[model samples]
Target: MMIALTILALCLCTCTLAGELFEPQANAQNTKASGATIKADPFQQRGLCRRWAHQSTVKNGTLYMFGGSMLLKQNNTVQEVPNTEFLQLDLAQSFQLSENTVPWQKPKINGDTIPPAFSAGAMYSGKGDFVFLYEGQTPKNLPEQPSSMWGYSLINRTWQMTDRWNHADENFPNRQSRGASVMTSDGNTGFYIGGLRAYENDTFKGWYYGPEEQFTVIDLAAGKKSKMERLPLGQKRIGPNVVYLPIGKKGSLVLVGGTGEYKVRLSAPVQNATKMDGINPDDVRLNPMSQMDTIWIYDIDAGRWFYQTAVGDKPWERKNFCMVAATSDPDSSGNKTHHIFIYGGGTDYMTPMFGMNDKPFDDMYILSLPAFRYYQVKLGDVKPDARQRMTCHVVNNKQMLVLGGHRVNSSETLKDCRWDELNLFDMNTLKWQTEYNPSDPGDSKFIPNPDVIAALGAKTQEPALGWEDEDVKCLFTGICPGEQGIEAQKKRSNARWRKWYIAVGGAGGALIMALIITMLFLRRRRKENKALRYELEQLQLYFQYQTTGEIYSSTGVNNLISDGDAFVSEKVRPMTFGERVKFVFGKKGSNNQEIPTIFDLPSEKRRETEVEKIP
Candidate 1:
């Protein structure tokens, strides 16, 4: 019975520890009612708007934004602004609607831990609690530094400079800024897709898609000295997004729509090219397709690339769109596919020579995978402004949080644009809700619309499909540690069970032995007490006979023996189960001495002090 109680107590402790790791689902319901914006009275006013090339990622229930060029209006002209500030938004604090305002905290940076300003793509390593900032364009005024990769640890709240991999170096591929990058499930391999080269005074030197579509692969674990390999791709991609699909033996990488390749050569004159009227006779410019409707898939395990023809209604070709896998479902055969949601982006952007322009989009589309199908979500009354280079994050698989991106306002051109407002799209309701008003221009709470809530009363469900399971080589074999084939996993599981059984059996045997030993000791102590009592009784009878030459009453002798037995039992009580278990499992005394039994306890009677006796 004591063993059962001990096991119950241990189980309770284990469950309590596990509960602290994950929060309860009650917050999900509260979030739905409160929307996404956090409003408090005392809030920090942080300007997250008008920043370009910045990246955002969610960690520890907080949103972290890093590295971007700020566009500030100075002296009636837009100027490229650089700063040494990093931003983090605490979701828990923001959700407290009781406060009138919500504030985002900027962590303190000591010395040169984080560079003042750089424009680049950043990725969050959830496994390591680190955020990697890739090399990107920097302002001209800043000191020229070697191209390098950097890391910021969320756990340590510190930034450290990592190894340098120069894009201009012959060893590396073309320089990338608006390119697509995605880390493998293991967070070791990073695949960088196509990006345009830096525009020189008169020409673009290394266009990623100039006859040769190439991508660079980096081993993130190796840091700066990591092997940089440039490999050929199917076609050139500019401003595309890559999604890692972790399903099959080796998961696949999918590249969504982007501006396809355009080639330029200085060797020959080009005809029918835009803005070639007064250009040099030797220069030729190729006009790239504004947008691509094609979707590219790369099989990581097989080192192969394939395209699937999506049958349903499809979205337009776009670039810099926010695309994320909101959720996934598995079939009866254990084959899983994800549901991807693509949001607003631009359609057309030309090279500097031809004059740059972008046609933004505000539509949303859902691409169901493995089946390669598309479903357009119609926004009835509300729609987000058309913007590109913006970031969208999924919130609990129910809503998408849209953050900062620049767009041409009614009175402004592309060069002079304003930041878009924070928007939230409900996946279930198919409605758009304003989250934070960067304009303020203050943090404001959004009340839910009654009509939209009524419309979303019925929950949406995904259609089921039957699929055939094919034998595929495991691409993620070592990527995810300990994840293996069914047979191997089963064998390992069986071994674990065997070891656990052995340990439990050994502990149980020890506990039983401890119980038996305790019982024997108690019995021996009782016998010794009885013998001592008998000896004392004999001595007491001798004393009585010597004093009065008369035998003591039989009743008096019985009472004396009874009193002795009670005293010994009170002094040496039996041990509780908890005490026995501790004796068996707890560390031994000095010199590895055996645990003391109840009989070994001090037998001294306490002497009352004067104050205690009076009290």
Candidate 2:
């Protein structure tokens, strides 16, 4: 070791350009590492061949893909090869250079901790340290036990299985159907409803039961396994995709279209479809409602299930497609409604076993919120080939990166996914793009699809979808949070009306009282004036009689006799009412032989208090 170090030191001293030598060394350090554990260049060692049904998820900007089947051609017959190679891709680095396909990396993990997990659900927990796999098919293509929860730790690169309901050091429960399951945005909880199989299976006696009667919650953050109060009776499904939107504290799960069959039975029509591989178009017996294109929603906070139907030309009832959601940013582009994108799946495996045969149902649809209408997205000139069982991961809140799917029918050529391509969809414009660029604003504004609008017709001012359930409506629009929902809006409306009612009622009552008081004032003034006019006429007549006749009185005898009798018979008038009012007020009573108005107070107060005279 010392001799090798001395020679390397001597070579470094002899080199002319040290900076150039170090540059390639830095690149080599990333591509080729310490041992045989890592791969060179593309970084992906497994899952390079044609495959499908693999599960994928993104955590901390890295895409982890694993567990699917590979299709191989041997002489005259098609072969189905089951794969268990866990791989990853650096999305931040891959999309920046981004050619025909996104790049993938293989992390050689050493363990036999988990069984075959192709049709299982994948979720990240504890802030992205571990990715948990829900129940799926075994290597023999049989259903895995519902009680067993398998998890892979990214930090340790090891897999370990635990009891479903039992938790000692870690948390797991929340079984998902063969369809699909979704976790909360914070990575703490999982929400799923209507399992095709039982989570606590004591015996594998039945393949399907009467529609699921349990709504389960696998709360990793709280470290408990429990069931919700909602038990909706609906058709059982396989390969359905679920989405968890954070509407309230518990959030809600949207159960979109899935394969409506519980068990696929191979018949003559399906037999001629394709000579395919593992779980390829199973002779599954579909439920009635599956063909009806139903959407089931479970509101976690309300603990209830709601049923809805879409009006647009919804893609024929199919499964094994990718569905992803992103909130809208009206300030830049798109409407204020949230959007869920559905793309690239088939009703059955219709790809020709030998060549590129375009399958039916090879289209995309958009489920825009608040209006819950389906719009067939107009695919641009460049579109992805028809495929099934692919995983779509949303990136940077603007685009969805579709990765890793295969046509089971194709043996020699790759039709569904190109191993060197990046499949991207711009959410704002609802357009498909081969390259991903952050600076590119996909669309300045999103206009509604005319076909869907025509089908939606004129709505009756109520929410088209969430009209039945307020909480479910809140999940989609500004209905529940930030005073943006109907309940919040109604509360505000009632408050405003209440204020107006109080103000108008109070003002009207006061005006009515003022009118009554004014009428009484005028009536009292008229009555007093009438009496004053009569008294003034009598005084004028009495004064005239006294001027015409005279009274002479020498003593009491003469006062009683002569014109005194006539003068006595005449009526005399007292002082006018106006003069009496003046005498009582304005200090006139003090000058007239009457006690001063201020001194006329009750005896005790007259001497002690010097009251001021009236003005």
The ten-residue window of minimal lDDT in model 2 covers 579-588
Worst 10 residues of 1 by lDDT: 606-615
Candidate 1 vs. true structure, TM-score: 0.55
List residue ranges in candidate 1 displaced over 4 A.
Answer: 1-49, 74-77, 95-102, 140-145, 167-175, 186-188, 199-213, 220-234, 262-287, 290-293, 331-337, 349-356, 409-421, 435-615
**What are the per-model C-alpha RMSD values against the true structure?**
36.6, 35.3
Residue 570 displacement in candidate 2 (angstroms): 99
Residue range 377-410, candidate 1, lDDT tens digits: 7776667567777777765445677766656432
lDDT of each: 0.49, 0.49
> TM-scores of all models?
0.55, 0.56
